[model samples]
Target chain A: MDPLILASEECDIAREVVCVPANVLDLFEFNSVPIFIGLGAVIIALVMYFALRKPKLVPGKFQASVESLISLVSDSIARDVIGPEGVKYVPYLLSLFFFIWVGNLMELVPGINFPFTSRMAIPLTLALLTWVIFVVEGIRKQGLHFFLDLIWPPGVPVALKPLVGLIEFVSTLIVRPFSLTVRLFANLVAGHVMLALLLGSAGFFLLGVLGGDISVLRGSIGAAWFVVGVAIFMFEVLVGFLQAYIFTLLSAVYIESSLHPQH
Target chain B: MIADVLILAEEATESSGIDLLIPTVPELVGGVLAFAVVFFVMWKFAWPQMQQLLDNRQKAIAGQIQEAEAIKAEAQSLLDDYRQQVAGAKSEANQIVEAARSQADTVKADLIAKAQTEAQGIVGKAREDASSEKARAMTEARQEVANLSIDLAEKVVGNSLDRAAQKSLVDNYLASLEGA
Candidate 1:
């Protein structure tokens, strides 16, 4: 079988199970997700360290732009969602956004066409971290009774208390992290798969056109798919930013709910 | 053929049901460590500076606004002082004009009075002179008439009379004429 066919078949399996490629380096045998994640983190750290090496009251162009990026997360995501006390969490949220964003942007790079976040490992880990943070915060603030309060909300009727509590337990404790992880992982995987399919089809069709065996109709279809592939590539860029924003926003919301459970 | 190929590919890639959704231990540990390092760097270094920059900007804007307000107040006070000074100067000018006018009036009245007194003195002296001249003329005429009458009598009688007797005779004739 062709390597492309084999890889596509692997994609189906990859979606269901984590497939460790035999050809990968020993260091990345377990999962390359952490290596890419670490690379993203290093890149972000270096950019931040250099960009804000000497923070100025009146910042230059690069510094101003970087400041604006930080402020966007701080003001829009953390502060707006989590309120005044969210100021302390701005750094964490900023790190998460930059890390995920840089990780997602790996798909656009020519040599590296794979996004680190396309894998479930990093997203799951991040989601688990968020889950832990919010749960701990809730427990610290509301005490061990936080679990009870979450499960049995104040407004439920006596008859439906058990049913509602069970639903809340599953949704808040189990489904929240699951959904957070799945949403990020699925979106990135879907985009990566779509891009791969489109590009692969374009390449295949272009070969058919160049081989002079295909009809004009098939050749035009190839050109059309190529154009579509280009368009989806651009769309993926927007998706990348949007996913990062949504992930950070949801994290902030969870943290905020933990801090102030009333809303 | 494509379906067969896909199935074979799926079979080739599939292993012992290790779910993709479940994170492996190494991946989890690496992710946690990496994220921790990044978070620490961000929280310790970048965030504080960004916050400080924002704070500095706020303080700078506030300070500028305060300085502007202070300057405006100072300008207002200076303007007020100038206005007051102008008003005072104007009032002082008016007072000076009024005092000059009053002084001029007093000097004018004094000059008029002095001129009137001088005129009165000149008129009285002129009247006195005229009356005295008239009396002298009258006495001189009377004496001349008496001498002419004596000369006429001497010529007519062809003789001269005694001084005392002539004087008495003249006086007696004049008195008799007056009584008549």
Candidate 2:
């Protein structure tokens, strides 16, 4: 079960507004996600603006670092994974990478402790965008035959052609975006939950020792949980970056596949 | 607060399973709208500037490389020309030296032949002069001997006979003695 949902249900039982609301409209009424998303976008825009404001032939330290990061996406992800044709998609890929990364890092922020990507809407939106782009690119490059390649793969024996085509259809059209969405969404949610569980449990025990009872074993367990929670929190930072990288890389791979479909 | 939040948790069976996976409409709408803004800002402004900077740098580097190659080729051509000029000058110098040596040899040979010819002409002129001087001296001595003989004969005759007869006798006697 999702820890946020668990927390929401607990909040509901206590008649309090601690976690996100359960009702869909109530979740919409909740404005924290939008505020954080705006903040992430603004931060990204400012960083990009400053990084390239005084574009130089000989780059300074800040410019070099920014350029190196852009190059990593251009060289390693888009061009490397999707070939020369992928140059056009660098903007989209760069945007996706940084946006998703900042969104994921929101979970670790002090006042705002929810990763925007932990919500299903953001990952779903990004994944759907990737799907639309690759599909459009495939159609643009290869024409209507793109769907034909997906539905009726070449080199299959006539007897097995139908089965293979069905599998390919589901795998290509359905699984691509679905997997993209779930992979990013699930990883961030899991990280958020793990942090919440560890820290919540630690605080419960430690608070009990300090406020109510001073038990040695409770204090030790609380200290251990807090230590582990801090460690996991640091690990979540890496997870945030990894998830962003994976999502962008996969998007590039899908674009490649669309550009050059397997016969 | 954390302990209270946790302890409040019970076996809630209300929302479970795939319901959690579903996305709310507002959040989805807001997320899409937010991302659209981000993508717009990035695609519209940032990317083009970055690409321009990169492209300008690339073109500048390429131009510099081409300029460097052109300079290197020009330098090589100049070096080759200088080497050819040096070789031509060396050959010309050798030819001048050879012509000067041959001219010196010819002049020396002509000088030696001229000296030999002059020495031969002087020796021939000296021999001719010596022969002429010896012939003159011989002719003078013979004339003196003949004159003395004639004078001795006149003294012996003592002037008794006529002058014409005496002259004839003396002539006959000298002639007869010469014959015998």
Candidate 3:
């Protein structure tokens, strides 16, 4: 038995591990990521089902508020950035925004103190979907010429064409999706990890104080850290909404560029 | 024993934690399918109703504006008609006044002419009557004088002269007097 193992076990970073649920059958092991995604889907479906089941020309407060959320994405993200042709993509963009938002907000729920987006898989998949959409749209609208034009922007000097093309390809094809995936994943993961650490340490301190082992100074520090954790929790709420907005906005910009690459 | 258990736990975590950053095939498939279902439901149900409501509102507003404009034009035309009718009535009243004044002037002139003609007729009739009366009076006086002179001559000659002789003497005397 290594003393290093003993020391490592005491560290708070161990809490960051993915939680795998027990296998219901011999076939598959259910996990938190899939469960939360499913939960988000159900919530979205229910909201749409009730709010839009019997729509009115004059909307009530609940229906109006829901419609306003939808139109915010439609008008600001899709129409403003992507223009009139963007009307076609409003539903898809709205779903993405709301799904991500709900997934991110799971961390705030009491027992479910984990955001699904804190995992890399969901963000990566969503970013890939965006990547596929923009690339396909570009190809469909511009033909094979889409790749050519994307790789070789018009403003560059003739001597630096290949260099610029390489940079452009790397950035557009690889870096864009990678950055999108990492930005959402990292922000949520960092918040998730920080909260776990602060709360975990606070719990330890509280236990020590209850057991009459911790000094008054350490107890007070633990209380202060707990307070800080609460404050971060609130801040993370804001971040969750912001990241969802930013991801949708970037997706709209990418789609716009695909549609009208001349700009 | 605790150290041994902690080492085993650390090793297990290190091995299994790799899956966190890497996506499982099942989860990926589930996410994509789930999102696809959501997108379909929203696109089919919600969007069309919202667009319809907005369009209905816009159409209602446009209709109201057109109706207001029509009413305004109708009111304007009616006002113009009333104004024209009033102008016509005013001119008619003025014409009636003018006609009545001219009729009064004509009536006054006729009365004056009629009165002057009647006065001249009365003056001429009075003068004719006076001249006729004077002629009658003068004839009557001459007859009286002749009768009185003949009676005086008869008295002076007493009773015995013949009737035919007296008459002839008188006539001869009278004729002599005329010749002298």
Candidate 4:
């Protein structure tokens, strides 16, 4: 059945499409998001394992590539953003980056066409993880004073302290995770939707043309849609990488903020 | 576009509230569990190994640099030692040459003095011999002349006087010749 045509015919069918299983076992059995999450983890594990299997003083191509990636996260993301103490968090940061990147790439994969991070739940989970770490790091590093620092940033004018304090409290505690989750989830969802629409429209129109429908216009539009879809597909690849970078970079920034609060 | 997507999504889910933003329990749990496992494995195995390898590489490079510096210093020391030895040898050679030249000069002066003394000795001996030979020749000539005079007198005077007298006359004439 043509899902787009069916969706149009009975827009009510959208409910059935969206009504996912709620039970824990049933959700796992039915949901591809968790399954893909597990798959992404496996891929990361295998790649890391194989990359580090035969460690050499002089690295080969695969090892060099893997080491360069590790250096990117460790040096560029963790150390550069979060400072020297960030070395301790390199593993978690590295895992987060690869996991999200692989999850984002799933939108382009054939058998699995849905990006796992398009679901709010997964991004929420990851963002919450980051939120927990940064908040815990803040508490650990600054003790109880972290909250005071968060609520009342130094150097604010006495007249505006209360206003600034309120804003800081919301921004630091509430908005950070929300923004992280929505940023990753919304971007992937939007990219996924655009791709699906363009490709689905292309399929529909091209099938009409191939089936000898009596419109030269449909064929041209289908060709155009396909071309644009391909372009968007390439763009999503970049976006996948960019979103993962942004997410991890933000996490680092948050961690740094926690570690070194303003005086 | 976002509004349209949201509307479509809302229609699909048939929920109009923030329920769309909410995650199912299973996915959140699964994602967390998966990431946790990955983080654990990475922390346990991969990153520490990589860190070790990186540290070892840095140490190896540092060791090599130190070794190279040591070798360079040793080479420089050896070169300096050789230069010092060469300088000593050159000075020693000059001294030896100077001593040889001085010794040669001394030997030349001694030889010249000895040759002069030998020449003087030969000249003195030659003078002594010439004087002796002259005396002998004069004596022989005088004796011969005396004998001839005696014979001539015997022939003329026919043994007029004694031979002893003639000998005495010859001796007296020779003595007179010596006195003149």
* Candidate No. with top lDDT: 4
CA-lDDT, candidates in order: 0.77, 0.77, 0.75, 0.81
Compared with the true structure, what per-residue lDDT tens digits does model 2 show for residues B26-136?
778778777777788768877788889999999999999999999999999999999999999999999999999999999999999999999898998888888888778
Cα lDDT for residue B137, candidate 4 = 93
Work out the iRMS of candidate 3.
6.5
Q: Model 1, B1-180: lDDT tens per residue? A: 234434533453355323555567777777778788889888998898788778888999999999999999999999999999999999999999999999999999999999999999999999999999998987687677677778888888889956567766776777687689
Q: Which is better, 3 or 4, measured by lDDT? A: 4
lDDT tens digits by residue: candidate 3, B145-164: 44555667667866545656
Cand. 2: chain B TM-score: 0.58
lDDT of 3 by residue, A1-263 (tens): 32222333354322322111121010012365587778888888888778877776668998888888888898999999999999988887887898888888987887667787777667898899899999999999999888888999878898999999999999999999999999998788777656654655565566556777657665665677688779998999999999999999999999999999773
lDDT for position A230 in model 4:
98
- lDDT of model 2 at residue B129? 86
Among residues 3 or more apart in sequence or in different chains, the pairs in candidate 1 whose N, CA or C atoms overlap within 3 Å are: none
Mark the 10 consecutive residues where model 1 chain A has the least summed lDDT.
Answer: A19-28
Question: Which consecutive 10 residues in model 4 chain B have the weakest lDDT in total?
Answer: B11-20
lDDT of 1 at B44: 94
In terms of lDDT, the poorest run of 10 residues in model 4 chain A is A19-28
**What lDDT is reached at residue B145 by model 1?**
68
